[model samples]
Target: MTDLNVSVSRLSPHQECALHPSFKWKPVYNLECVFCQSTLCVRGMKAILLADTRVELYSTDLPPSGATVLVEEDYETRHCECRIKDIACALCGNIVGYHVMLPCHPCLKSCNNGHFWMFHSACVQPHERLDHNSNSILLWGSLPTSTQDDQMHSSDNLQWTECCR
Candidate 1:
């Protein structure tokens, strides 16, 4: 079983005790699969407003639909006016959370254009929530070719320092 201290909640006013106030609604770390520790999305992907203050919505370019298999069950919320599909880890098959597409809410755009993963905070492991003002670690994406040589060196140092300390 995943070493998740946080409990999953489907109800609104989600378990607030599990979240850090500073990063409660902010993308402050990578969202990883609780079962396999595989990264699903990173911090600062994009933010979306949801009706629930307890639930924070973030947009991910990580093949939102294709990567994970959706469960047979789905839910439609009148508040959001959208259909939600329960998404499971493609590898471990754990019910991570759900995603909504083309919701009626103004804050939430049509996810059909891209897609948004409404992850259950408990279902995801928040990695690298460290506060640093220095050269930000490259958690995802490739370094530009021009700065590749310099960045690789700096990235190694950053990782070592971050990991060790």
Candidate 2:
């Protein structure tokens, strides 16, 4: 298999363009559920930034203000029709994420479906990770215990923030 992990500084201009520079970490291939290894979304999938909020992933904190944190578009294989979809591991049925419902306001009429995909970084494991300063790193087939510790403690002092339903 090709080494999907590539250092950010060495990325081709085209590849850089494909990424949201504001995001701290990005996957090199489609993410898979750490529990079941079921594919979730492909690498280079653009995320939609929610205003003035941060999400607590398993190991890292995601600040969405200027980052591509929420995935609005679903990959072809993981499409859902429910207004509030549950993102589960296909093989194990472990709920790993959510498809939150977006309000249908006057300004937003394009997404008639009223929902988007948001996978918890803690629940899904990336096959390859893009490191800004060094070569891409390979993640484990399952989430590491240290990462779980990070996720578990990240929300302790956080103020309540609104997320999609």
Candidate 3:
């Protein structure tokens, strides 16, 4: 099999385009449910910057084939109150993340019109499929763990401050 060169980088704090003209795009990766290893998202889905322990997926992208959004429920984050639906693994029924139904005012711009989906970093694993014709996959190890020093470095530039705990 041909070797794939994947550049995985820590997600930076969100910045407005007007202030940061040269924004770098993070590479996309396939994600799988950590519990059952079922594919959650394929390539072409880029991770958006949220909190350190969550992975954000766009609502416009194809929904995960191995998961489903459940009924909406009230949820509270550190900074705001919102309504969200739990995203569970279809194969195992494990709660992997959530879809924002009603975002708080500060999160409205980031919510993309209720199209934001978040996956717990601990519940999903980032991976790469070696070949589309086969069932082979390459796990990318654990998601990035944030340290106090790292948090201090980027705290001033955070765009989306509200996050589910």
Candidate 4:
């Protein structure tokens, strides 16, 4: 059994939260699995938007601790022939996403480091840490925006009014 060897440095909290410039969806820390509510990844992480429903995380960004990569079967993407492995929730064994094993040249050019982990939007949810010392969390389907219309999306099964802090 191959387990994800997580370095403690990868999970360290950031001094300040910095949102990705292109994607203003949410701050990239304290994301949790939608099914089991286990923490997927946290702190100082950067993401690339593969699609409206998928987000990609670089290998350096610390892949989800609660997920494991299954190397049993290799699959290719329809858009690109990049080989990938399925990523499953370590705790619940639910297929959460995929990890890129090999990237074609074109994919490498656009994929920054040529490798990343992709998570489905519905499979994972983002949470804001209200206080570093406290366990309080503010959960939302989407980031709070200036306009009420864009404050939350119903498909994510989260609402701005459901804050737990």
The candidate that wins on TM-score is: 4
Of 1 and 2, the candidate ranking higher by lDDT = 1
lDDT of 2 by residue, 76-138 (tens): 222223344445644456776665554324314432211145567777775544332354552
lDDT of 4 by residue, 1-165 (tens): 124221111211221133232333223345567897755544313456443226454232335332444646878877677887888766567877777788666775652422267666667776543322233332122223213322122312242223222
Query: Between 2 and 4, whose TM-score is larger?
Result: 4
The lDDT leader among the candidates is 1
- Which residue runs of candidate 1 sit more than 4 Å off their true CA positions? 1-28, 43-49, 57-59, 63-67, 109-115, 129-165
Model 4 regions lying over 4 Å from their true place: 1-26, 43-60, 64-66, 111-115, 129-165
What TM-score would you give candidate 2 relative to the actual structure?
Answer: 0.37
* Model 4 clashing residue pairs (backbone): none
Model 3 lDDT tens row, 1-165: 245443333444432322122222333455677897765554323445343225454321334332444645647665456666778866567887777767766666552322366666677787543422233432221112213223222322221131111
lDDT of residue 71 for candidate 3:
45
- Report the lDDT of model 2 for residue 40: 49
Deviation in angstroms for 14 in model 3? 21
lDDT rank order? 1, 3, 4, 2
Provide the TM-score for each candidate, comma-separated. 0.49, 0.37, 0.50, 0.52
Clashing pairs in 1: none
lDDT (CA) per prediction: 0.48, 0.39, 0.47, 0.46
